[model samples]
Target: MRFKSYWRTTVVAAIFLHFFVCLGLALALPLLDFEGAPIAAQEMEVVDLSEGDDGNADTEKPEPPEVKPPAPEPPAPEKPEPEPEELVLPVEMSPTEAAELDETVAEMQKQEEEAKKRGEDGKDVRPPAPPNQEVGTIISSGMTPDTRGTDFRGTVGVLVDVDAQGKIVGVFLSRKSGRFVVDQIVLNALKTFKFEPALDMNGNPMKTKRLINFPFDGSGPHPFDDDENKRMRAKRELFLRERQQQGNAPAN
Candidate 1:
């Protein structure tokens, strides 16, 4: 009986020890699971951070290109000024040349004075020829002689002196017509005569003298015919008779 009781006690002690070991094992298993899970999560977060860093590096902006400065411009060239022209002077004159110039000037002045004297003396120099009438032509223009009004009828002669310019210078009666009126008519006609200028041996004009004769009485192609003269003479006689009769009549 005692041996059997001791064996029962040993068995109960082994059972209680086994029960405590199992409870301890259960609590240790929970702690190990929690610690292992946290370690794995920390490794995953580290990989994701490494990938994000690579992506940010690709999206970053690039640096700007370096600018090159332009080259400096060259300075402009300067213009040159024009040079002055050279001057040339003539040689001085010799003593002989100076003397010749003085002589030439004196000769020129003397020549000028002589020319002036000749011009002054030329005014009084006369032409070498006398004046004459044109050939085959007489100066009978502007003369109308009327012998019918008077009883006196005669021939008249005149002498005329003409100048170098064909102008009448002087007139003289060489023969009288017996009547004063007839003489006056001849004188006036002679004064109006024009002539051609006569030339001397040198072919230069000069003054000249000439003589002319005129007749009245309807003779030798005279200006008045015989019939007209008779008619005028009869009229004049009648006028004279009337005047005499009037004079002889007694005053009223």
Candidate 2:
């Protein structure tokens, strides 16, 4: 019996020693880390092995994504040219007056051309004061009535430039009549005028300028301007004196 009891006691003691050793080993395993912390308490690190789509990490920046430049804008269109302007004319002279003026201008031009062909004929042989406005030629007055019911009246001063051969080379306005139609009619009529050629000191024909004031009223412009009358008087006296001298001269 003593032997059996002692054998039971030994078996119980061996079982208790085995259980304590297993528990101690389980607790000591978590302290195996050098920092004495549990394995799960430490932070775990992760690494990426991903590369470029071409399988190489340094694959030429994917060809710079094909950065295309913008296209240029189209050129602008050109503009069209402007149209011409039309003038409205007013008839201030009667049929008879117009016809007379035309005939006079034509006759004067014909006479001047004939005189020029004849080479310094006795036509412009006298040096009348202020030149031009010879005694024989009758130049029609400027500025006929504004037959239009407008009753517009103003003085239109015109500057005429006559050439050595009595041709109307140029005509310009020295003063405006403030009426466009009236001014234009005066300008056009003045163009048809011809002057007697002025004479130089040697009695040779010379170019000259004259300013004539056309004063308009209820009866259109007066027949002649002041300057015109002055020149006419001077020229008529000179012409009469020349004629008297010729008459007094002894026959050759």
Candidate 3:
């Protein structure tokens, strides 16, 4: 009987606790007061103007006046004067002055000769190589084929009148390798040459001559031959492959 009484008391206590909790929660919640002061909604104001009326109600903008620049003054008249008569003077050159004049002329001639010599000695002259050769040199000295082995042969020379910018202005076969193939090789190899230009007396760059030559390998084709396409293609492929591997791996 005592156990039964205890169990009944516990059950009744649990039911009362649950009822109290629910009732407290319901009482704690805020009440919705729909009957209190209501919010007022604002209405947009509309205005209408006649076709001839300005939109500003209290102020009107004035029209701008036309502006005219002042007139330019007339140009001054040119003045003309009389021509003067020519005058002659009975001046005589001294003996010393005459001697100096002769010396001056002689010195100029000597200078001209010296210049010519210097030009011949590779002093102020460009090489007499072909344009292509000059271009090759300017672009890359390596492009200028070497005259080493007969099998790996080429000529060495210059092209004259190469523009200051290294463009071939003229090609001269100065040091020919005696083979048409060799000569053509020199010419063809120069197509890629470029120059920084040679300077003149005034330090300004001027077109000049250059010289180059090549040798013939009885077997090898001319350097200028269009047979380098295969080599060029291989180089291109290699470059592309290198670039392809240069970046980080794409996100998987």
Whole-model Cα lDDT per candidate? Answer: 0.52, 0.58, 0.50
**Candidate 1 local lDDT, residue 108:** 41
Per-residue CA lDDT of model 1 for 183-248, tens digit only, reads 876665444345554444334456755445566675332342233224334544564566678879
Q: What are the RMSDs of all candidates, in order?
A: 45.2, 22.6, 30.6
Every model's TM-score:
0.30, 0.37, 0.28
Winner on lDDT (1 vs 2): 2
**Regions more than 4 Å wrong, model 2:** 1-149, 220-227, 230-234, 243-252
Lowest lDDT sum, 10 consecutive residues, model 2, at: 82-91
Ordered list by TM-score, greatest first = 2, 1, 3
Task: Encode model 3's per-residue lDDT on 1-252: one tens digit a residue.
Answer: 344358788999999999999998798765656578888999988889878677877886677798999899898897787663222211456889656745644554354345345454466432233333322222223254444444545434433445676566655444456666656656666655544554443334566543333444444333332212233235445544655666555756
RMSD of 3: 30.6
Over 1-252, each residue of candidate 2 has an lDDT whose tens digit, in order, gives 344358788999999999999999999998787676556777777556556455456655645677778887787776676553222232467889667755644554454345334335444422223444344332434334443444666667665666676666655555677778877767665644545666554455677655555656646333344544454557656876786798799999
The lDDT leader among the candidates is 2
Clashes per candidate (backbone, < 3 Å): 6, 0, 41
lDDT-based ranking? 2, 1, 3
